[model samples]
Target: MAKCPEDLLLSGCFSSVALIMIKAPAPMLIAVGMYLPFDTTFAVFVGGMLKLASDKFLIKRNADEKQKTIVENIGILVASGFIAGEALTGVLLAALVLLGIPSITSLLTGQNAFEFTGSAMGGWLSILIFGIVILGLIRIPLGALKNKVQ
Candidate 1:
């Protein structure tokens, strides 16, 4: 008797963990990619590539094992923070909607709900903000390692 989706366990619906363990990201990409702009997908791809490249660079660096471990731990913490921030933002936006306040999206876009990519200026601004965030992500971990070494 699951009233809400939150209460409904996958265990109850699925007979075994094997079915749950099967990830189908291709189906997800096919379903959602149609609705997203090429810029969005390209940006995601670039971010993933940067992640892979950074991982390789870190492994090849001449830092001692302890320092590398510190950097790795810092990276994990930064990534966890990013994920938590996203979740918290979603929750805050939902709370704003429940409270009848304009969510950040409508506030930023105006009453017309203008898409950020609708104009060149908006698109560039979005890119600038995204770049700044990526810079911050890289900076924080590096700063941590620097401090640990000093």
Candidate 2:
């Protein structure tokens, strides 16, 4: 199932939207089934920041337990990694754009590759076609190797 365009614009995070599509659906469906949207990287980062800030705000909050401290520290580090990775990807994107390669990462998959769209297909249809192409490219090499082994 496709995510409506508005969700993409509002969140500024496409991980669940794309992963719910091209990568995994069952977990996403289960999350949606529970009426809780999966926390995107943005949401998680916000939550992590708030977790720390809110902890600071409340004087009554208990002293940070060992496990909680580990978790919060890890959260901060993970958030930093996500920020760094995004910056690096943007720099790479600018380089690719300058070279005139159609190198945009699809919101559906974080890969850099050319996408195909048939003349008659709508935009969403083109993405489905692109997924099939990606699957084939992945499988054909495996198939060839299997034949050689046989």
Candidate 3:
């Protein structure tokens, strides 16, 4: 008797469940990374790196419990705001597409001003902007510590 594709899929699902039941997360993380788009995974990787950097900075500064709590709260708030903004932007863009309306950029410029987005210079500019954002993430919380100290 030959096994069907459904049987193979079911076995895969069972194996995944077993992995989870055994408290193993590496396989799950690998599976999710493989399933998600490159940009999505890259964003997650960047976020993880930012978190690591933040932790290291805090340790190097010899932050106390109260200081660490303040920084953590500020970071969480900032991250939440970013997540909300991104979600809202995504919804707005999706609605515009569904309504057959031009994007805000096109409406403002009377054309696609982002045509250069695919260029090498545009990529560099994006990286520079992202680096600025990363710096802000690291500095904003630590800056709060400074204010509290003074």
The lDDT values for all models are: 0.68, 0.53, 0.82
TM-score of candidate 1 to 2 decimals: 0.55
Question: In terms of TM-score, how similar is model 2 to the real structure?
Answer: 0.33
Instruction: Give the 10-residue window scoring lowest on summed lDDT in candidate 1.
Output: 11-20
Per-residue C-alpha lDDT of model 2 across residues 2-50, encoded as one tens digit per residue: 7688864555345556656776735554344344455444344444455
lDDT per residue for candidate 3 within 73-110, as digits (tens), equals 89878878888988999999999899776767786777
lDDT of 3 at 140: 86
Highest-lDDT candidate = 3
Give the C-alpha lDDT of model 1: 0.68
* Candidate 2 lDDT: 0.53
Worst 10 residues of 2 by lDDT: 137-146
* Pairs clashing within candidate 3: none
lDDT of 1 at 2: 41
Tell me how far candidate 3 lies from the true structure as C-alpha RMSD in angstroms. 4.0
Q: Residue by residue across 44-131, what tens digits does model 1's lDDT show?
A: 5765665676567667766777876776677668767877998999899899889886656666665646455568978888879878
